[model samples]
Target: MSSNAELHTLKQRTDNYAYVLRCRETGLCAVIDASEPDSVLELLARIDGRLSLILNTHHHPDHTAANPELVARTGAPVLAAPWSGHAGSGPDITLKDGDPIILGRLRGTVLATPGHTLSDLCFWFEADRLLFTGDTLFSMGCGRLFEGTARQMWASLTRLRALPADTLVLCGHDYTLGNIAFARSLDPHNAALLEWEATVRARKAVGALPPHPTLGLEARANPFLRADDPDIQKSLDMPGADPSDVFAEIRRRKDHFTA
Candidate 1:
């Protein structure tokens, strides 16, 4: 199989799971979450387009640390949710639900996804069939239960999963290795997960990032997505209950994942 690079100036700095997206032809790019100062500037300088927008998935520093500096350097328009006050963002353009934007020749639309945070949003480039999942949804798992409930995250994941299967998911970070490791723990017997782990390990071994752009169907096989599946409830020592309740319990277990 061949690699298809979606955005021309797309680069991922795994330091804090931060990714940068810039349009090549226009010299106009949007930094998804700027973490490392030099790394982001290096990519920005290399790109032909001028920096026109800096977007923050949420107010996390690792994702927003370079926002002020990037904005100052390029005088680019900083766009973020209305409530993500002082993510070092101070975006000139505040985006809300259903807002459509034209970046260079690409059309970008905002989906007000608020599971990770009340103001978190995802950017969708319909023509290109690219969806930036941010911290909301990962290749194998979902975000933490920070400001929202399991129900909200569940709904958000469902909505995103509903997008066309071909929609390329450009999530915020490269947490694939770690996330898959956790997934393996829950369903150690899942052959699909075992096979995935082997491939991801090989990729990471070769210094190749393994942030899989998995289709919605592939994720369905993941126990994490089956937050409400009856089989999942059985594994969690519960059965015959509301899906939301099952989801909440699963999130509680995940909260203790790193521990």
Candidate 2:
């Protein structure tokens, strides 16, 4: 099915991102990761949309700090994972992996990706070819295992990797430049990575939002997703190592990576 959803991207709170999704058919709207109420409210007003649902990817303050205010302002019900520890208004309807999210004619699927936080849930609007990854998968990087194990993180990433190559990735944070730097350090000879780095630099120089990379580009360029690649394993001096172990090592390197 093709998408009947209109996506509006809003940059909020420094590096964080909040998305507004509107169903074109029924005019129903939903906000993903309502991080900043003022910005989200302004956009909603500009778009003349009545917020129907406030979707939370995780319980992190940067991702959900405005949940209560948004709910109060728009009377929109919150939808989140059962374990989501949202600050004020709790989830009106809890979601799980494979659960369907309906916004008018647009349908999305909830993907349980518990790497950044055990409660992390990504929304995949297959018809639209959009994946809203909340800190679980970045452009050229993945989230650090703050509350979960490396193995768990790897497993979560694997699930995302299985998505369609053309799917556009919308991440929670704009850490693309830093992630690119890290990716280049590992895969210096990757033409795709090099080309992407130039594109990102150009966009950043113009103060534009980082380009939203496709899953196919990520599979070829992102070292985190390429943990099973022989080149990545060899670069880490862990040839023939388990993919999980390779992912763990990459995550470890990224944690301390300054450049």
Best by TM-score: 2
Q: Compose the digit string of candidate 2's lDDT tens values, residues 8-96.
A: 88999889999999987777899998678998889888877878989988878888888888888889898998753435546889989
Clashes of each: 4, 0
- As a whole number from 0 to 100, the lDDT of residue 233 in candidate 1 is 74
State the local distance difference test value for candidate 1: 0.69
Candidate 2 has its poorest 10 consecutive residues by lDDT at 82-91
Name model 1 segments beyond 4 Å from true.
1-15, 84-86
As for candidate 2, its clashing pairs are none
TM-score of 1: 0.86
Residue 229 error, candidate 1, Å: 2.7
State the displacement of the C-alpha of residue 30, model 1, in Å, after optimal TM-score superposition: 1.6
Q: How many steric overlaps does candidate 2 have?
A: 0
User: How does each model score on TM-score?
Assistant: 0.86, 0.96
